[model samples]
Target: MSHTIIVGIDGSDNAQCALKWAISHAQKTDSQIRLISAYTVPGVNMSQADIVYPADFDAAVKKTIEDTAEAAAASVTEAGVPVSTTIVPGDASGVMVEHSKTADLAVVGARGRGGFAGRLLGSVALAMPAHSHCPTVVIPSTWPTRVMPDAPLPIDLPVRASGARTAEADGRDRPDFSGEIVAAVDPFETDTPVLRAAAAQAAIYGTPLRLVGVTATHILAPEWMPSEDHLVKMYDEAAKSFDAAVESLRADFPDLEVRYSIFDAPATEVLVSATYTADLAVIGSRGRGGFVSTILGSTSQGVLSHAVCPVRVVRVTRRQPGRRR
Candidate 1:
């Protein structure tokens, strides 16, 4: 089976940006590109309408799909890469998710037709990476370079072996974790899964993991003034949770080095700011709130749109019923 890099295209500017990034990466890795476009038939009832058009709607849609595919393929071909195209009729996110199960990587634009305003995460993009069996990369519109012609795309390999604590030349001790891992934890939510994933990735990368948790609160207080003690206590509470989460992962990764930070600003801002220094940022879909809640909280959505690095959204699939910590 050919390892493929799948991209969701809707002919939008953002989609094109994603397509360019995917094309470049695919070229570097010698991987085939599957440029996919999804279209939906407008709901119409022939009985209600008095006039009927001579041309068939399905045929028009088919032509549009083919045109989009050709355009995408042409771009990749210009870059000297081999690419194929597919057009499907259905939900865009659903189709991409199905294809991602077997693909090496699924790439999507930060903003799309279905994404929310104020940098809130796109429903489809957020959902796909959260549940995807493979690694997913959400490329933001403002990435420093739109197309990488000569830069070699970084590839992450799963962890292979375990080692002891050793100090590097930089005076920092080497971590037991093996993979490149970063964690984005919401302070309001219990961060068990985020911690677990980070530890696992660190083990795989054999690199240290950075754990970042954000707490957004109003700047003002009810009392005469917000005292230093109050601020310290708030941060202390957040720190306690951060430490607890890291501790739980310690048994599995004895040499894992975890760095935790608590930010008292908007969750999205804090997380995105940290992404400037990270390879991958891990975040939970919904926390505290049940499944009925939205896929991303306001902070997460903001970060999704403008993060400096790639984002990995972890969706909660199976949880112990009635279990609360």
Candidate 2:
């Protein structure tokens, strides 16, 4: 089977941004794009036998989506990328999740056609990534607002490198490959799948991979510790260990620049800020704090709720990757 990247489109600005992102990314990866549009008919009364389904209405909806998909396909082809189209009648999240089983990656917008302002995680965006069989990337609505820096990054103990961006002379969409790829490290034993996915993303966009190790009390918070200083010391030790881990793994991908740092802050907050200078931020569905019944952990929710750039949530095993300390 040919490699495929599925993109959920609803004609919203966020969906358009997602389409653009998927197109540019597919072009870089040489993967074919499968654009899908799903819809549901409201106010269907089963008791009314005389009432008929509106064929014209259905036809009109199909026409609109087909046109949108066509336009997207033309744009992708113009960019020298391959594209395909599909239309389904059902819940948008359900359809996307089903297709994700066979897809290389699934892309969606932060919000869809319906939702209130300030809502970062729409029903579709939240549901797809949680239920997807593969990795899912959700493009934030505020992505277009990103511009070249007018100020310096926040100075902190943990090292940071601002992925440079040179604004275009004419004001148009710039491909997202310009910034670095930020990946959250679990410290003890990183999730190989998530790290591999992040590395592949960095390699595809020709960007650097910044490994951020965050140690918080949420998971490793030992109540038995005498004071906060001890916890910080433990967190720092975990962070420094990643230095050797990356050293061994970076050799596997010589083309990618892998750098790592440790910080004593909330994992979600640090990752959300990283999105500002990162083309894409990747995290696992469950962190050290995740529960068995939880579909998404608290850290994933915090970052996905308020990120500027695109965020990806890769599925992890039900249990934590490494043994607890």
Candidate 3:
């Protein structure tokens, strides 16, 4: 796939942060930036019942968005990445989702100036991952504040890639540190694709793939595990799944340094803890057990909200009758 990354801008601080994050990523991957600034004609806009619509109101709104896109393009150009900007005439979320269908990745700020002004997570950030055609990354407001000119590429990987960083925060935090990439899984029927996504990411970064399978031991097993012996057998089965998954990735990328971990704790807790040391946390949008949900599963949401590193929530697109993975 071409390295095309789409990011949203709204003249908000968080949106600017997302744009800069995208620039940094493009620099690392030698990708192109498609900076999009979406504008909407407000319901109570000047054309309301009591007010006269200013002749220049529409032009002004378009100009403002155009300027935002131009400035974003300038920044990317200065950073040595080729960029393309667009002043989309529509709602932000819908415009982004539409572009996501043809892009390799889509990124959004945790929150922007919209519906709920003071909320930490915004409507667009929450909406994209669940509906995007590719992986969507939501950059938090509290990002690693390293100077852009001084930032280094993620690591020594042959594949072009971009990911999150655990900020010690360039002196803002007393101790800055680097971290790994964690691929979270449930080892259940639904998450095999999640595992593949994580493995692909690990391959891209040349990072050690950490396959963390989390489960709560006290939770009652299904009817098939009616006895303690059956429970033991289930545990053994899970261990085998863990190893097999790792082996599968190793088979694909012989040099990949993979690790297997099983924790008898909540899936959210394990993945969040992993994020502290992970540059990126990869998870499926749906799974069984704690991750059982339609789209944007509870477990995935927990990690997205709490992870110290950037999280990539990939939608496991089920194969259609005549489609490919």
Which digits, one per residue and each the tens of the lDDT, describe model 1 over residues 1-325? 5569888877666678778877766766677888878777666587998656546887797787788779888998899777888788888777888888777778887777632111345656676765665556687665635232132222111111112222232343322122345676544344466567656656655677776654444445556555678767766777776667666666678898776655555455556555554656776655542111254555556657667666656554444221111
Model 3 sits at a Cα RMSD from the real structure of: 8.0
lDDT of each: 0.61, 0.70, 0.67
Worst 10-residue lDDT window for candidate 1 reads 153-162
Off by over 4 Å in 2: 46-55, 114-119, 147-178, 218-233, 289-293, 320-325
Best by TM-score: 2
The root-mean-square deviation over C-alpha atoms between each candidate and the true structure, in angstroms, is 9.7, 6.4, 8.0
lDDT of 3 by residue, 95-132 (tens): 88899988888888777884212354677887788888
TM-score of model 3 vs. true structure: 0.78
Residue lDDT tens for model 2, 140-223: 875667643344234234522223232332243221224678888666555356677788788878888877776554455376
What's the candidate order when arranged by decreasing TM-score?
A: 2, 3, 1
For candidate 3, the clash count comes to: 0
User: Worst ten-residue run, lDDT, model 3?
Assistant: 153-162
In model 2, how large is the Cα lDDT of residue 134?
Answer: 85
